[model samples]
Target: MKKLEDSAKRGRPDIVHFALMEALSTPLFLGNKMRVYVHTINDRIIAISDNLRIPKSYFRFEGLMMNLFRDRSVKSDEGTVLMELADGTFTDLLGSIGAGKVIGLSTAGVRSTAEKVAGISRDVENCAFVVGGFPRGHFAQSTTRLLGPVYSISNVGLEAHVVIARLVYECEKLLQEGVDHEGDKERGKIGA
Candidate 1:
């Protein structure tokens, strides 16, 4: 929370708060265990990992997030506050996650077709999909360089929340269909 607030304060604006709430509330992300990383305006990254239950009510959420940002420690009625990574940049976060593929969501990137994007799930175990938190513009140069592929889910620019919801839903569906399992089986047969 502190990390989010600090990032929002530095220059990102309130868009970060809304994006965080939307992503946390989505069924794809809520039902599955996933980690969310917030890259603040000041180049600091805040990671929310493990069991994360964001508030449903906007007012309660705003208050809780604000409090967390200010105090750096606060109990939430909605969910447990897990670990936080401080003083880190987007690049640092990616590096710590190892050499996994990093996909950045961007307007100028390749269009996502059903056929081409379906393979996304196969890389889920070792990929990070990043959505910009700011209202406008592109990701920083440092962050862009770290990305393996940049994709635009919509022809027109969509809000951060919409992009995240759609991406997560598609990825989760592919995961449910056992894309990884099928690939592994094929690999074993080939090896044998």
Candidate 2:
């Protein structure tokens, strides 16, 4: 993988790892309020189920991904697919999820706040957000074409993990549940 340091071809699996750590453990994701998917540099999509816990270590995540690629999917002990892989473009992913609107977060896109974007999400059913997994540059032309509205959450370029953290926080705030399983006030996904 060191050889890919000089190449963009699968060069930043760690970026995806870190972003998953920020997202998968959040209340919004853990409470079945949201779903996550990774669109790789090679055009493969990995759909992550909310119940699956991501490894905090990069090496473990690397090993898990190796198995996932080899098997093309990961299943829980009870037989629920934890993570599933498929060959698809970004457009295909949005369509498969029945996304009403595909919003992209890119440094190259129009400027906006995370809350504003989350606010917009409440208006659209099954809204999806696209955050790049690479360390640098913008979304490819093909990916950008499928996005309904691209937004920049910062005045300066931000790392993918940062954008993911901020967006998740705002979404938790904007979409918090009125009552939880225990009938307590808990921040959660929109309409949960």
Candidate 3:
């Protein structure tokens, strides 16, 4: 058997599973402002439903992924596509979304705080953040070609789950702030 470290093994689907869970649990997601797209090592993309209940158990999540690959999608009880395989390279997904700004998170990127990086969501149309799904190594050239801004949020390398959680938290906070700001504005108009 070829013994590769767990992270180095077969693109590490578990890492992607955990990262998706992190992002899915955020307020940014609950508020319906976030969408998830996964680009596979084999040049396919997976689009996750905003309301899909991601399995917490690694074994279950692995099974779900296998089923998705086999059937090309999973549907809700109502037959809505909860997850599906989509055509395209990572670049094609970007073009289809028309993301005004695309930022990639990497330890190799320019040092920046989560606050500044998360600000990409403000005053932007379809802002997208690229968090690596794989545990080790950097994004492939196909992905990097469309990754516009690259930011580093840590002094040391961190796991994909940690990065996804922290970034989603920051983005969620910004979304809340916008809501608060709008409410305050409406109150001022009423008082005027």
Candidate 4:
């Protein structure tokens, strides 16, 4: 909450907007399998998935988000709107999503080897890979408790956009190879 308040005070809500855009624009999301839940600073959870479109311009995105935050709803010609806003904490939102595992990305967490990280998308039928929306600082204690395993993609701290892009890219690659939780070896084998 302090991180979010700091960003807002600094007039840098664009950071959060771009983080969301990075997640939604990924091939994994484009394939219509992943969902995004944003726990805002004001204690509201904004759930967006499927049929979502983000503005290409940062300022435009900022404007849209500002309006949505004010109005709590905004419709688009593309039929994309703020899906739903629920009153809750981050844990409540996670519980509602019911992902099998919630992996949090943070520099403070253990460094994950490539093989271990590569299996993330296939390890569970439903998973939520959470990245902090605020510019800096760690997740709240309650939220951290809900995370299954916190992993760091890089030795040094990474920007949210970079982390999200790399993680989603890896997940998409594995998913494209037909790797799924059911362990269908035949599906991942090319020309089988």
TM-score of each: 0.75, 0.86, 0.90, 0.81
Lowest summed-lDDT stretch of 10 residues in model 3?
Answer: 1-10
Write one digit per residue (lDDT tens) for candidate 3, span 53-73. 798999999988888989999
Ordered list by TM-score, greatest first: 3, 2, 4, 1
Q: Cα RMSD for candidate 2?
A: 5.0
Q: Which candidate, 1 or 3, would have the higher TM-score against the true structure?
A: 3
lDDT of 3: 0.84
Candidate 3 regions off by >4 Å?
Answer: 1-9, 189-192
Residue 126 lDDT, candidate 2, scale 0-100: 93
lDDT of each: 0.68, 0.84, 0.84, 0.75
Residue 114 of model 2 has an lDDT of 91
Residue-wise C-alpha lDDT for candidate 1, range 90-148, written one tens digit per residue = 77778776636788788988988533553664656667778887765687777788888
- Model 4 lDDT at residue 119: 78
Per-candidate Cα RMSD to the true structure, in Å, reads 5.6, 5.0, 2.7, 4.0
Q: Per-residue lDDT tens digits of candidate 4, residues 51-107? A: 677787987887877777777776767656645666898778877888788888888
> Could you tell me which residue pairs clash in candidate 4?
none
